[model samples]
Target chain A: MPTSDDKPTPNTDEPVTGAEADKAAEIAAAKAKAAEEVPPKNPWEEKPVAPTHSDAMDDDDVVALEGLVVSADLFTGAVTATVDAEKILDVCRFLKEERGYAFLVDLTAIDWPEREEGRFDLIYWLHRHEDSKRVRLRAILGEDQTIESVESIWGAANWMEREVYDLFGVIFENHPGLERILTWEGFNGHPLRKDFPVEGIDTGAAIYPDVYPPGGGPIVPEEGEGA
Target chain B: MMNGPERPLFDVEEMEISFGPQHPATHGVLRLQMKLDGERIVEAKPIIGYLHRGTEKLFETMTFPACIPHTDRLDYVNAAHNNQGFCITMEKLLGISIPPRAAYLRMILAELQRLASHLVWLATHAVDIGAITPFFYTFRERDEILDLFEEYCGARLTLNTMKIGGLPFELPQGWLDRCAKFVDAFPAHIDEYETLLTTNRIWKRRTIGVGVISPEDAINMGLTGPPLRGSGVEWDIRKVFPYDRYDEVEFDVPIGTNCDTYDRYLVRIEEMRQSIRILRQCLEKLPEGPIMAKAPKVLRSPEGMVYGSVESPKGELGYFIVATEKGTTPYRCRVRPPSFVNLQALPQMVKGSLVADMMAVIGTLDIVLGEIDR
Candidate 1:
């Protein structure tokens, strides 16, 4: 039953109405006889603690890991690279084992269409469970490229890889089973790809019982069909 | 059927199930071509874009300032946060510094958006798991946030509040005090939701060990926001990247372990509390100044590119803008939607869980289909 924008509440944008205007006149008329009410200062005034940037080389990144890279981005210097696909599992193991970058913040792909060979960039944001220092890494891959799947490393990769495949068309080499995700059966192209038509599909898109070929959608939802 | 694990024509094997193209739990129109062995999932491949509106290409044709409202539809639930992220990016590319008051105002609205987003997460998460009452309780609070938005910016769902230079207008008077009151009472309200499901026996049984995403896999997969944090990752862009007044605010980044469906739920609940903390801090120290920066009446950004992202309730909501030397329209606009990346973890989490648990897992991840399909 909240009123629209023009009308106001006590804490929000206040308004003048028939009864309120009369009451306000009455209150104003009695101002000489009444003591004013002064509310306390706002409690939401507390400011946020300054955050630790990724380049700070805090204790969170100083892990004694087996194959940790300990490198920074050439341009920004704010990003740190601790592992690559070849050593993905080892690096993840080392990070989890040695340092406290326990939370895997996120895995997603950014496309740089201008780079002929280096078409897509896969980015990871790492977080330590104990604190909030972030570690960001960018892995460059070419067209029809593949990175070792980390499903074995992080159970969450199973879906992240599918999203990459769905949007950017970046293949994860060791992914258990990769196929179209987010798009329906017979969808003409990956919607997130730079070259992919944003308007999408020349046809009716997904059919309820649509059965797709390998690498397509409407995949069989029954078990034992695809391992 | 020897111990060979039943390769091809195994008739005595698992049963098949399809979750949605328009199912209730998928949130929006996401269809999961999920395979199952009886009630246990064998493989779950997500099929999205059922609601794709091509928000990116649409950006190319829009004026520099006209695109703000369109971005709101991307994650329809967190409209204010989405608008704020785009506004920051354009400001950066233009190199126009925002007034201290604008930053504080933006931060307050953004935090409010976070609270509202988390409320939706709780409601949908509970509803997916058949805890219908939490949805109602959560919506009641969400409505309050929506009310605040309607007063500040006339539109509720697709708020076009941000202009290229700064806000389209000043923060409506008294808006902060009302917001202050809501956030103050919000932590207690979050505690109520926790009491409803946090230690509830049925909730624990359904979520505890179901759909676990280990920490290692979560990192490699590129999951951002709370879902990634649920696996014990502490990377919040607000604390790490420190955009806007978030750098000045003090709050904790909540993390989780076991990376289970339930852990994600817990992480989000705690996150809502921390957001309240950020809000309280913002309101107390909000500087008094102009709510906007001076700019050319019409904007044409210099030819350059900038990546602007905010730690949105869903995840890292970002915008990559390529401006031409002549800045009337952007050369390209790309949205780094958190829901899109966050949704990627679904197949893995749901792989071995029941179809029912798949719904629970989806709810726990707290994805907005508009964002996922954008």
Candidate 2:
């Protein structure tokens, strides 16, 4: 074997030789091109942008109902029109007949007791299958205000209106057989109202009155009162 | 004409009867105040609320993340979809997109849940219709699904496995392999179930044309999921509003030609196969990434209302959440339960059918009183 010093060695002073320098430059250029051509980030990696509510005053359906719509808001690609409570039936009929919103997706109420305009906001979600578009019609109601029932327009609203009536105590004017749905007929107080306690009140409909006391379960004995 | 007896042979008076608050065929505490003309049902009025736990009211008092468990209780058999619907609505309100891995995981879990839910429906429905054998067959598969669920999360029935921004944990060791094994074996099991019921004469006679609701009537009544598909309306929330990687998955929405109990049954069975197809695709194209998004420790929602829906096994399970600015808890959370809306059409479905056929109609509707009364 040749001695270590006798072997032919390249110069250590220069950083890179001509051929090696060419290879390094090619690798760097390839890396830069690859970085430029990197795939787009996934939906989750991107920051989510919240949808802002825009004025839907120029929407075709909102424009059609000239004075009926109090205000129309478009948020997250869904249109919500605040319509007059008095002309709800007319507007519902117009939507059903003219606009083909045959499906009443949901009907519910949100209680805003402190609002000066109204105490309850009734939301009606309607779906048109032609384009899979949904529109919401919100009508404000006072504490004792009654709105017209869209039972005849869409049969699906019959039970939904009754549920609102039962839970929020908002009466539907023309709802046939509008009885309490989610509560007993004689149960006192609307359970969904803001004033209702979360722990629940005594409904006085005890199953075993003898074993458990009314409004309270089996009484726990006091520290000194029981053995 | 043979004159057997004088002065009216038998008195035929319309009778009113309460069907169930505890009957097995009614599923849960659904009591039907029915008017009957001899053996035929004149009218059936559904009296619900016995199972009502004030779920919506309870939602108002809890933090956004804490409310996930309560949603599981809404449809006990289909808890995963309920969690998904609530989380989707919450995510929309907070404007937080989940990671790719989380989305794929959610799809897998949800499809598994759909399989489980439909299995329960089939078991209960078959038992209700007097085919007790299919119950035994279906529950075997349902137990394996529940086992997978128990392996993933600690709970089986009420699996609160989802979080707002992402999943709570990454997949355990060999979890994906086990899930793949199950997915591969599930199609054969479905075939086994079909062999037992699909072509059986008794199943056909009991289900075919028993509960017929026209397509227009089904849409007007707001029927969804299998019920809507059974009426030949090709409307699926998955196809219409693709959420959580559903758009990337390739599957067909099985529609029915004739709107009947049999068609609905066929639709659900085919839907099970489509779910398998989706699972295969999701498994093949599952991307590797961080499971959780960069979310704040305390999630605060913007002030507004958002309505987000998912294609649940039952139907379009929607959660309409109303949030105040920077509020941790929802102002008003409304659950548009599919069973509640589907159960509303019971009166129309069972009218003029025999008393025995009422069980078939109820089974076909697949109304869960837990959801109906929620």
Candidate 3:
């Protein structure tokens, strides 16, 4: 993260021109004066304070679930628990039944094709409506690895898991009828993969406009007697 | 041939029928591979993705601010809510607070959008249920709402009216008065719709006790918005999460008791009234300040993830944004569309219901395939 400490300052060695130098000196003086002035208590500018309530998980603390949660961190307004891939089912059950995070808000995958930790991060967002709290659980999976499906816990995860399978090629073990949900069956590549081209690929069956004759279909080759 | 020996009377076979890749009542290109035992549905497997434009992928390639317009296309009918969800998530990621005026403006637009979306839902849902006249009446008010949207933003359906920090444009001159006028008279139109279908015998027969989802099943299925509320969940993100000044507004979260299609209908009607109440409050309390926050010229969020949701007309419209450290574009932007989640309950809902009642259930669900297929 690029904090204010890491921000680049103006080059001090460069000789400044007359008007520009004057403006720079004036800006420095204004900044010095502004620094001396006490900042107002602007409500909009208030930073997010960690909730004082007991139920809310502290961002900085690890849950200490020895085998299940490897590490937990709070960032960007939600607590994300990095769980052991094989133990995701156990962690989800714990959250749903014990912790009361019943509703599965969303299940999605983030593809990190170059990351050494894993190829993909399967994200599950669970919402506990009673406390209006949402917690995100992330399970790191290597290429071609499979994770247990949570359809038994949350029926809503059925389509969502299928979507992740369709778009990211992540397999969900025990997912009933895990066919493509967002893409047609027999579609070639996982489009959401980081390596997938934004312009899209030309499936050889249908000649894409950018591929064959512009503004038209595939060009059929002349019949050949001998090759 | 006619006497083909008792065509085996009482010998029942499950018939598999493919419904709607193009059928009118299926909403969009939602195709259901339904297995039927006589006229009763045994299984219904919805085949989606006809409208998938690789929106999440599209979001990846575009800059943060540029992704707002694409969000508009996900839930095209509820475009403002879509915009709101994306904008709110982006704002959370950037840690910027929008001005009070901007927040109120967003609420006004969002509530109006709720009205517009529900009207569209009512119009098409009624048309699907064979109530044709309500479609015309609902569209009249819907068109007025669209006109209001057009005056505020430049477009009606795909209103990219919201920005990441605040809003893209201020409310047009006299737009609020027109909106107030429309809000003032909107209940009478709801009354007209009610007079036509709320008590109609055919409407009741088509909707009541059909596609029923129990409250427990609804929560387990992760149903949100009206379907969950209709099942008596009493959960509304607007009230629960309270984004963009919703906590300051006064409106009831109408929930249904019977958990039937009729109750869902009643819930939606009551919801439109509640939207009006919210809209009236926003209009009265519209604040005065800069509409845009002091956001950076280019938006770049610190590494991590955030999930922000709004209670759209259909359900919880959420955006799960994952921004990498020092990145202008989101590493991943997942749209938690309500229709997609709500559609999961279809097989369960229609299992024992008649095939014809399928349309009624689809109507009651009020799904927009754009969101589902996204």
- TM for chain B in all models? 0.94, 0.98, 0.97
**Full ranking by lDDT:** 2, 3, 1
Quality class of the docking in candidate 3, CAPRI style = acceptable
In candidate 2, residue B187 scores what lDDT?
A: 93
Task: Count backbone clashes in candidate 1.
Answer: 41
Query: After superposition, which runs of candidate 3 have C-alpha atoms over 4 Å from their true positions?
Result: A1-67, A207-227, B1-11
lDDT of 3 by residue, A70-148 (tens): 6677675567888889988988888888878789989999999888989999998888877777788889999978999
Reference-based TM-score, model 3? 0.87
Compute the DockQ of candidate 1: 0.12
How many clashes (backbone atoms < 3 Å, residues ≥3 apart in a chain or on different chains) does model 3 have? Answer: 0
Candidate 2's docking class is medium
What is candidate 1's lDDT per residue for B1-374, written digit by digit as tens?
38966567655576556678777787888877767786678888777777777777678778978898898898998888888889878877766666778778788888888888888888888888888989989999999999998999887677777766567677778887788889888888888998999999999998998878876666655678887888887778887777777878789888988888778888888888887887888889988866767767678676544567888888888786767676688766777788877777777777777778887888877888898777
TM-score of each: 0.70, 0.91, 0.87
What ranges in model 1 sit over 4 Å off?
A1-227, B1-11
The residue-level lDDT of candidate 1 at B194 comes to: 86
Pitting candidate 1 against candidate 2, the one with the higher DockQ is 2
Candidate with the greatest DockQ versus the true structure: 2
